[model samples]
Target: MNRLDNPILQVLESYKAAVWAKDVNALVALYDRDAVVFDMWGTWSYNGIASWRAMVEGWFGSLGTERVIVDFSEARTIVAADLAVVHAFATYKAVDADGLELRAMDNRLTMTLRQQADGWNIVHQHTSSPIEAGTAQVIFRR
Candidate 1:
């Protein structure tokens, strides 16, 4: 494994650990100093390390005994000279404080990583729900 590989895996593994451990500081550690995180459901964009740190803090506060289990699959990594992209499919199941299942959703995630002086940190991320296979080929009704 290359030095870059360690951090790449660490960042992703940290994400999984953070969800399970509900550790906000651990999650923030995976991001770059100027990273930006955007969720499809919200207009709020978390920018900069501090802002992203705060965002994770909020999630930790809100969890309130809720737990998340992430099933990650089909992970493929592409490495360039100094950057890498990891593409994977994921299913997340959230259970509330009472251990009742809240929701289960599937999405595809692309994490773009860059090598920095400190380590390999996620610079950008894009995630989208699985699209229907034939949805793109719309046929107008006669």
Candidate 2:
């Protein structure tokens, strides 16, 4: 079956929607209360939902008059009973209030989720980009 057809992957859709709208509450709702996140920017790690929410708030707040569009490609998922792991190439495009694209970046994203009473909730999330071998600068695009 296609990965998109799987119910467990629905969180990804919610994630994209939340980010595009800069809806911090909806985005944080996709994670477990005890979720842990290793974001690609700024901090090294976020230990729980409270910490993750703060990061999300700051990210959306920093956008100002710009909005971010998030897209996921080359997504793959493995499901084993009540646990699932998903990895994908994620692209983020920044657009102005008028919808003109300003900048974009791509990164690798991996999320581990657990099937809960409500639905799949991410327990852990990690996002990263490759580094230049010599300069140690991040490679935003493949």
Candidate 3:
């Protein structure tokens, strides 16, 4: 199937749109009710949809006057009959209400999705960034 017609890609597009809008409900709707997430910041892991939703809410809430723009590159997806795994390098840029860039960071993202009756739902997600050997600080650039 063409990339443009891939359901997995559609999910990613939806995710980008949701994040850009800071729509917490729309963002969490992409995941399964029992999803697990290992986010790169703030906490070790989120155990379920509720936990993940809380984190997303906090994140969107904290933005206040800023909105995040998400971009994905080098995305690779493997799909079986009912399961799929996708990994990509994701960049997030925070922009002011006027759309001026504030700051940006890059991270690695991986998600495992299951085909549900309605559509593909992310069952597991993990995001991380490399640490510099000397400074032990996160490397946010490609």
lDDT of 1: 0.73
Backbone clash total, candidate 3: 0
- Judging by TM-score, tell me the better candidate of 1 and 3: 3
lDDT of each: 0.73, 0.92, 0.94
TM-score of each model, in listed order: 0.77, 0.96, 0.96
lDDT of 2 by residue, 46-126 (tens): 999999999999999999999999888988899999999999999999999899999999999999999999899999999
lDDT of 3: 0.94
Off by over 4 Å in 1: 1-7, 96-100, 130-142
Q: Model 1: per-residue lDDT, tens digit, 100-134?
A: 88877777788888988887788887766644477
Models sorted by lDDT, best on top: 3, 2, 1
For model 2, name the residue pairs that clash. Answer: none
lDDT for model 2 comes to 0.92
Error (Å) of candidate 3 at residue 16 is 0.3
